[model samples]
Target: MKTSSPSDAPRPGHSSVAALLQSQGALIALVSILLFGALRYDNFIGWQNVSDVLSNSSKFGLIAVGMAFVIMSGGIDLSVGTVAVLSSVLAARYSNYGIAPGIAAGIVVGLLAGLVNGVLIARFRLMPFIVTLCTYIAARGLALIISDRQTVSISYEHGFDTVGQGDFLALPIPLWIAAAIVLAGALLLRYARFGRAVLAVGGNEEAARLMGLPVVKVKIGVYVISGALAGLAGVIVASQTSGSPTEGVGWELIAIASVVVGGTLLTGGQGSVLNTVTGVLLLSVILNLINFENGYTGGAHLTLGSYWQTIARGLFLLAVILLQSRLARRSP
Candidate 1:
């Protein structure tokens, strides 16, 4: 009988460590940042600042969630930001029709836009990057035309404003909505057959097809989900800012950054919804710290403005990419 040596035995702890790094790395980073901020700043631990962070993070969190799904499916939706703005424009335009109608209209527009993306890419075999880029331009123009290149205000009396600004249990309503989306996304990606198929397709499309998976349906479904979530994000933005056609400009980059920082592979087939949330919070905290630093110095010493924030974001993205590359190389 052959006897197994120490080196031949499987090392469970090693695998566990690797899994933890893969799944909760962003969470670890977030916690570290939070601790650092709390210790370094005076008001960073204040309730008001915390609330502000959660509230502001909600909109981007929602968009990032959808983008996470798309990225996991080996696809990208560059138009999500513009799509969100378009949805906001439509929601504001329909606000007078009643709250339900207003919200429904925004969601429908998102669904329709997603359908177009899905059909074009999955059916016609078009490149996702080019298709979404085209939609990005078209959606922006549509938003401009619909809102007449102006900010469309939602009536305060219609209860539509409360969806974003109101609070429950002392937390902003948008935060609650974002939490719900994240939970639902986690469940979908964890326990659903559709989720498994998405992973399969993303991991290996040809193999997925050979395995009798609904490759086209799964691909299209992810885009539809992305579009609908982006639309919901738009509605939330409209409620918060009284509606604006140009609200989500440059948000696509932020969403992508969040996904990348969350430890999700840009090549797709690997990501976590919870990690994406952590990524959003991490970026928000960093921005908040920058604002605090700027104000603390009274624009004299460290007067880093929005441009600095952009640079910081670019640097953070570069660091994450380099880390990912090293990790990938180390993996067996």
Candidate 2:
């Protein structure tokens, strides 16, 4: 009888405490930041600020959710940010036609880009990093070509801008959209067959193949998802502001950071969508606190806004990563 080694094959819900901490660590950090901000700044926790934070984080949320799935599949997507840039430009350029057409155009751009990536990686067996990097460059160039190197402005007659600006039940529409996406992602990862296959593939591609799991299909599927979501994020960006080929530069780092901070292992397999969302919020809150700090300092260091944000986000992410390592070691 070949018995499964406990270390090699953990049962479901194994190391519940460690798992709990790994998932909840970001939540705890977010709460701590909020409390600290509240104590130091007037109206720091005000509803208006809260709403704005949610709205601002929504774009990253969409991208990050897709990123989490890709990471869980033991792959990476450097093209997502640029794909979003392409989608935003497409969305803006098509806005004059009508809302539905504009939205469709953006989604189509994303879908097509994702399909290319999927085909290249899964079919050709190319390195995901290289394939996505090529896309990162190609998408940006395409966006620039389409927009004539200018921001693609949207016509407001179709009210397509409502996606980024409108409110629903007193909350931002973007928030609702992001929330819906997050919920769907969580449900799919938690209960769907495709989700299980994804985990299996990430856990061990060769073993998953031996078990008759469709490894090619899953790989292609994840890239498509990452590309499509990135495109959707671009649409949101165009709606909120304008689409520029330069918009999503370095944004992929944000998605990777969010995934990592949320306890999604870089090595793949184990992850949580909800925790990824928490990571997004946590980073957003950290940026918000930076703004609050500047205000408290009377804007004496306003010039350091971007630099400070990078520093703060980096430090927080580092902390979460360290915490994740510790918790992983503690897990049985």
Candidate 3:
């Protein structure tokens, strides 16, 4: 037998290093931010601060989970945020008609928007980017029209307010809702046949189709699901804010960043929903820590504000893209 080289041994050290970089970016980021905040601010880790972070995380967390599903299916949904805004507007409009109708209207709008995106991409072979962009604009315009460019308040609806604003054992209802969604998403991704079809299609559409997968239906379904989740998030935000159409602008970017930062590939096919949850929590914690630290430093919380968060998220996307590109190059 040929003599074994030192490099051929198991390379445990190298493997560990690779695993760390591959799976721990969000965790590392979370830890670094926590340590920095704890050192820089005395109250950063207090229960109040912890609650604040989770509350903030719930909103984008829900959106990010849905976006994860869409991204995993080899697509994107630029329209999610705008569709959310549109749904919120509709929700507020129908609140006077009763809670059931309002809730129904919001979900229906979301599903319809997703259907538009899915049909365009799956059936017409249109690019997801262009299709979603068009829907984004259309949704925003529709929202503005419905609200008459005004803010509609739903403070009178006790049930609606409870969905968005109530607390459960001292935690916001949205957090519980988000956690449930995350768990459901994990199950779907891990065990559902439809979920497997999504992964297969994303991995190689031609091969997946050749293997008799319902590639087109799965693609469309995920987009629809993504839109529905976004819509649900909008309703929650509206309830939390006491009903506001302006709640969802720019949220799509945050959702996209959370999904990507959590290790979901923009190129699609491989990622974990649970990892995406970690990514959302990490960002939320970092931003909350920044605000807490800013107060200690005697700086305005609104000064640099979320601008730094946006910058950090962009850098994260760039880094993951570079790292993944390297992995792809080395794979052959």
Over 173-207, each residue of candidate 3 has an lDDT whose tens digit, in order, gives: 88898999999999999999988998888888999
| Total clashing pairs for each candidate | 0, 0, 0
Ten residues in a row with the worst lDDT in model 3?
323-332
Identify the candidate with maximal lDDT: 2
Off by over 4 Å in 3: 1-10, 297-309, 316-332
Q: Rank the candidates by lDDT, best first.
A: 2, 1, 3
Q: Which regions of candidate 1 deviate over 4 angstroms?
A: 1-19, 297-301
lDDT digits (tens) for residues 31-59 of candidate 1: 87788778767778899999999999998
Q: Tell me model 3's lDDT, rounded to 2 decimals.
A: 0.81
Candidate 1 is scored at a TM of 0.92
Ranking by TM-score: 2, 1, 3
Candidate 2 lDDT, 14-52, residue by residue in tens = 678777777788888988999988887888899999999
Q: Give TM-scores for every candidate, taking all chains together and pairing residue i with residue i.
A: 0.92, 0.92, 0.89
